[model samples]
Target: MNRNKDKAWYIADVGDDLIYIAEKLNTKANSEDYHFENELLMLKEVLETLESLECLKEHSE
Candidate 1:
């Protein structure tokens, strides 16, 4: 098995997980809950980074 492909798949999986968490947070968050907003933002940033990594991995193949 190609390690790079495996790594890319893992990254994509994590990104999907982050997206799910973000969706849940959005549904459960209220206007007063700044913490939830912050968490969602952080998740978005991490997901973006993971997407970039996946793109690079594909290009390197």
Candidate 2:
């Protein structure tokens, strides 16, 4: 399988989980119940990396 396609599929497969985490980050529970800033930051970084990969793939085509 193509690397980019594999990455895309992986992203799609976990899309719901990402959304859930993002929602949590925006909620009062996140502010009062736990310290998830680091994790959320990492998640955002991973998403940025995926976006960069897609952009690079498009330009390199």
Candidate 3:
């Protein structure tokens, strides 16, 4: 098992929540929404990176 599995899952959960909130708002009509969108994007990247690391750890073990 990946040592960071818990952390990875937590980050992914947060990212999912952010994405859901952004989608629910769907504030693309307003420029202010860009900030949330950008944050969601960054969080997605973090989630992906953590997931990848977790995969690597699993494979190594």
TM-score of 3: 0.44
- Relative to the unseen true structure, what is the C-alpha lDDT of residue 43 in candidate 2, on a scale of 0 to 100? 82
Error of 1 at 38 (Å): 18
Which lDDT value does model 2 have at 20? 72
- Candidate 3 residue lDDT tens string, 1-61: 4556865686667678777666655766454544455656766776787777678778878
- Residue 15, candidate 1: alpha-carbon lDDT: 72
Ranking by lDDT: 1, 2, 3
lDDT per residue for candidate 2 within 1-61, as digits (tens), equals: 5876876776775676677777877784646668887667868876786777778779878
Question: How would you encode candidate 1's per-residue C-alpha lDDT over 1-61 as one tens digit per residue?
Answer: 5867877676778778787876777766654554666666777777787777778768977
Alpha carbon lDDT at 8, candidate 3: 67
Q: Which ten residues in a row have the lowest lDDT in candidate 1?
A: 28-37
Candidate with top TM-score is 1
| Candidate 2 clash pair list | none
| True-vs-predicted CA distance for residue 8, candidate 2, Å | 14
